[model samples]
Target: MGWLQSLFSPLKKLWFRLHSAPKKRRGIYILYEDVKSCPYEDVHVLWSILVESHTLRTKV
Candidate 1:
């Protein structure tokens, strides 16, 4: 009975650590190629619009 408790104590600690650890957060990143009509400026504008739209949608 004592040996069983000792083994389970470590297993219980391992399970607790796995559930309580913080997870890394990540964001979406987009890469675009520069063209005649769609240069870096246009690309960034589109990106901002998309991000803002997503933010608004999520807030509602």
Candidate 2:
């Protein structure tokens, strides 16, 4: 019984970690609002670069 208790303790902790929501907020809503308020040309360029790189990687 003692060994079983010890064995399950780590498993229980792992389960809690796996199921728990992230602790910190990413502030995506704030970023989206800011982008909507003042759209930037550089933002579009950066987004296009990111998309192009992603597509290039996937093609390989």
Candidate 3:
């Protein structure tokens, strides 16, 4: 029994090495910065254009 256990000790060590607890402190987070003109400017312009047309146009 002792010899059998000793024979499998290397396998047990290998399994523990493979399934060890993860070290989460070894991670990285990359941040990015961006600068651009607003894309929604067209939405506000369309709303104003529709309002101006509503005032000038005729309705039934």
Q: Which prediction has the highest lDDT against the true structure?
A: 2
Candidate 2 vs candidate 3: which has greater TM-score? 2
Higher-lDDT candidate of 2 and 3:
2
Give the per-residue lDDT digits (tens) of candidate 1, residues 1-60.
999999999999999988996755545433323332465676777777877887898899
By TM-score: ranked, best first: 2, 1, 3
TM-score per model over all chains: 0.41, 0.49, 0.34
lDDT of 2 by residue, 1-60 (tens): 999999999999999998998775453333544554567888766656766886788799
Q: In candidate 3, what are the lDDT values of residues 13-50, reduced to their tens digit?
A: 99998899965442111111111233566755665576
- Alpha-carbon deviation at 6 in model 2, angstroms: 2.1
TM-score of 1: 0.41
Alpha carbon lDDT of residue 38, candidate 2?
63
The TM-score, computed over Cα atoms with residue i paired to residue i, of candidate 2 is 0.49
What stretches of model 1 exceed 4 Å from their correct place? 1-39
lDDT of each: 0.70, 0.72, 0.59
